[model samples]
Target chain A: MSGYNEYFDKIKLNEEQHQAILDAVKKEEALLSQAAENTKQKSSDTAKIRFMRRAGLIASCAALLALVIIFPLGKRQSMTPANDKIPEADTVMSSDIRSEGADASLSGEKEVRTDAALSPQENIAADPGSIPAPAEEPVASIITDAVIPNTAKSDHAFPEESDRSAAPANEPYECEFAHSIEKSGEETGEEGPVLVEASVSDGLLIFNGKSYRYLEETITDESAFDAGCLAVITVGGDALLDPALLDIRSGMFLYGKEPYDRLYIRLSEDRFLCFVPEDN
Target chain B: MKTAEEMVSAYENMLYRAALSHTGNCEDAQDMVQETFIRWLTKRPVFESDEHEKAWLLRVVINLCRNYVSKKGNRGNAELLDIYPAADPEEQSLIEDVMSLPAKYRDVIYLFYYEGFSTKEIAEILNTRESTVRSQLLRARNMLKGRLEAEL
Candidate 1:
């Protein structure tokens, strides 16, 4: 090993080679520092872009939150005055009807107008007997007033004392009037007779290519007849039944069940359009 | 830590010789030495002593020379023969014989003999087992002995 070391020791670089290495090292050092500076600048720019993106996202979220809080309050404030004007119009209409000399013979109608002027709960409590039974009341006039706005009567009818006493004692006065009043609230289009293909199966009423699930049988307490037909069946299914289909204006109380286990809609007194299921 | 200029001044010759021993080309050797000093500038490795610093520099130069030779393929013995033109005929022949050995044997022989490192130190420098260095050293010595004897 010592002898091999003596031979390798003689192998050395000359003066010219030494100068060449020093020159190369100086040039390489300058290039390395410039590259490091450029890398530092690029990293700082990337950090600024990331921060701005986060700030933009936060600002957009804040704006969306402000809209969500403000919109509902604005809608509720706008709706208040319109609701307050309805009772004022009803008072003005009752006054106009009373001024007509043609209605002077209608004392029963004057009582109904006075009752209509009262709030619903006060009218219900003050004289429960004043409300008319469904049979004694003309179904056409009620349907015309509630379902067809243009043909509505100028003098609303009220059943006389003799007619009220003649109606079955078990009959519900509120349910018949309440259903008609509820139908009146809807914005119905032109009234025309509609013939819809209908059937009932598994508690679903299928009519006009649409199926309605039986939400409930509306007359739960009374025997079916005293409630005036076998329940006012409400329409419930995947979608609402268009009220215009039967000139019913409202789908809620249009369906009735007779003694024959058939579904029928009353068009007027002594007239019912019955749905005979296809299977029958 | 030394500045890049100070490190170049201090360790360039030793690194250059070690690199030349592996590469067998003065230009490649000088390039390897410059690259090793550039690494010293960039890495800025902390060392316990000047001996530690020298060993680190030597390891980097040897690895650079190895990669340069591998990428360029095996350098010719004819080019290596010109490395020692100033020496006597017998000395030049001996130096050429050392350069002619495979790179692994040349590394062990040079580190163990010229650099005067122990087998343990050579193992650390080469990143190998000390026993492997001893065996390579034995094989290198036998080859050199056979070549020198045949020439005589």
Candidate 2:
């Protein structure tokens, strides 16, 4: 091929094209070098991160999870003092009605008198203290009543006024929160209504698989709410009392604490079921 | 150690021209030049000598151009025809004629003659045997002689 050297030389690029490629090479070289330096800096920075920093990140995630488990929301967590985890019965249990032997049927089937268990009006006629044998019968009937809230509205079967076991009108709540079990005997709701599973969706709080819309701002973060403890709001001295909760909706939460506030159950950090007390 | 700038200066023209032989256009040729250097900077392969480094750059250029050519409907070098218009008609004819040769022969002829590579060096760059390169060179010369004689 070199026999015609001049002919092959003509195929070689001229000055301008040669210099143009050189200019492009210079431009690309600067970009590549900058990119390489950036990669080196990133690698060095990543290598310099301490092991303790990674450990601290993991520890933070663990702590967040632990806090999520401990606190029942909807009440003020930051404002409510940590020491108030356990509140006095009289201060929080104001205006509640208690019934003993309510869950005695869980022990075995009890023979309840259908006649005496008719209504709240009928239960008031008997001296409940004198008749312990037939009390389980009416209490079991109350459980049957609880199952059918969607069917018929009944006057609250507050344990008979004559029953000595009834807590004072001031003493209402039979607290059964999961947290209170280890600390004290407060969560032992021997006389409380059997709590059924309930969930909140949109504005309606679903209890006993029936939907009832709340009359007020009951839930803040609805996603955090699980099935709340089932309790009926019944008429008390001045306001409707949620028998499941203490009057002071403090460390835990309630849907409504105002008079005639119905169906207030707190399951989460900032969510509740607020129903109109008139509907109950 | 040669700086990246020094390497660019040393190999850019040869790589660009090598790319041009395959692409037959300046824009795609410049693209291959950039791609070859980018691979060199990122891969940072240690070279045994200047010949090894030059051969590596040329091989990358050839590979990049090969990919460009193999793409579907890639017969795109109309701009390359007018690039050397100021040259005399015979010089222009010769450049056009060389590019018009089959790619394998054109590559061997470019390395053997214009770039002044030995058959061994051309073989190393193309990743072929030196004897195969010599045969390719002879065939390319024979083909070029006949074609140019007819056209000129």
Candidate 3:
């Protein structure tokens, strides 16, 4: 053997050195085993979330059928010439509906309000089951809105017009949420720009091409069948998303992985929407 | 699959020795080994053989050490120095000589002499070309021989 080989051969490990090496290898093996277990656990949990989603959809469809029967009869009786003196009843009911809708949209509460304002004739002709069905077509139309235009040069012009239109006179304009009943709780507390209203047309929340935060709102506003739909939120619970800025046209998907994360949808000036893994 | 206890008894010492030579500290090396094992257990990718598993473990430990070193550098911390007990009176002098070598040379030499890794194996472990490993090994040998010869 060469002199270098002799020196290497002469080297010896003490008991402590030998013990340390064994410990490290054992630690690594244990870690790998644990990781495999975690993966199995996660896969099972994801399957459960998917099942719950399907059950929710079926329940909603059934509820819409019942609303058709109740709303028209109430509207006809409430609109009688003898009951015409009670205009306040209409206002009170609308406010109550707004409050109930707000509560439903704010949390994950279910709503099943049947608007009693529809004429009896209109109600008889309309299919309650199909009230929300028309909205589904708009979902397809919103997809093109998500496609960003090459506005690199015209970014200034668009933002200027958007901001000028939003300038407050005395009080901010009331946000008309499509399925909302109350203002966002965060909007009431903060000094920055607030989402006063969100308009729901079809299944999409139209925020007038502007950004607002849903710091206090839950994802997918209304829960029950034929209930007013609200803007769905996703992310760190503190931020808002700009609804109008999202190029949602008709049938655009609201939430997915990379598209949702990179959508630049800030519900509020300070908060941007985040994508949470459904499994989590 | 081996039981946790069997794995602990069989491989802990080897991993610790490898970690110690890489990091030059008992505590840091032990922590690195423990962390590597924890991560392995948590993120288990299937392995083909015992040898492959061993390589993967060693690779994780080494990468962890590199991260620690890089983080320390970012924080402006001093590099680790030699701290092992000398085997003899003459060996005490050799300790300073070996420890004073640059990290680039020290790593290959320690793996070759202490870990018993072949040049090609060391290169594979370090994710470097075999020619680079050979060149570094030659340079490390030449430097250590010169230092030992001078001491003699």
Compared with the true structure, all predictions reach lDDT values of 0.55, 0.52, 0.47
Looking at model 3, residue A59 earns an lDDT score of 76
Return whichever of 2 and 3 wins on DockQ.
Answer: 2
Per-candidate TM vs. native? 0.49, 0.41, 0.39
Writing each residue's lDDT as its tens digit, candidate 2 over B1-152 gives 77667876777677877877778777788778877877887788999988788888888999888888888335655566666342466666666667778778778877777778899999888888999999998887788789888986
lDDT of 3 at A65: 62
lDDT (tens digit, per residue) of candidate 1 on A237-267: 1112233333221222242111112233322
**Model 2: how many Å of interface RMSD?**
4.4
Which model is ahead, 2 or 3, in terms of lDDT?
Answer: 2
What's the count of clashing pairs in each model shown?
0, 9, 65
The deviation in Å at residue A115 for candidate 2 is 71
Measured over all alpha carbons after superposition, the RMSD of each candidate to the real structure, in angstroms, is 17.0, 18.6, 31.9
Residues B6-61 of candidate 3: C-alpha lDDT, one tens digit per residue: 65555665666565555666667667776776666566667898867777777777
Interface RMSD of each: 2.6, 4.4, 5.8
- Which pairs clash inside model 1? none
Tens-digit lDDT track for model 2 on A1-280? 3333454334454567556655766676788779889999888787667556787888998898777775555234532431232243222322122212333344464422213123322332343332223232343233333221221114333223243122122221222221101111133354432333333344344443354434342454534322233333321111222233323232122323322223444433343334432122
Each model: TM-score of chain B? 0.95, 0.90, 0.81
- Candidate with the greatest DockQ versus the true structure: 1
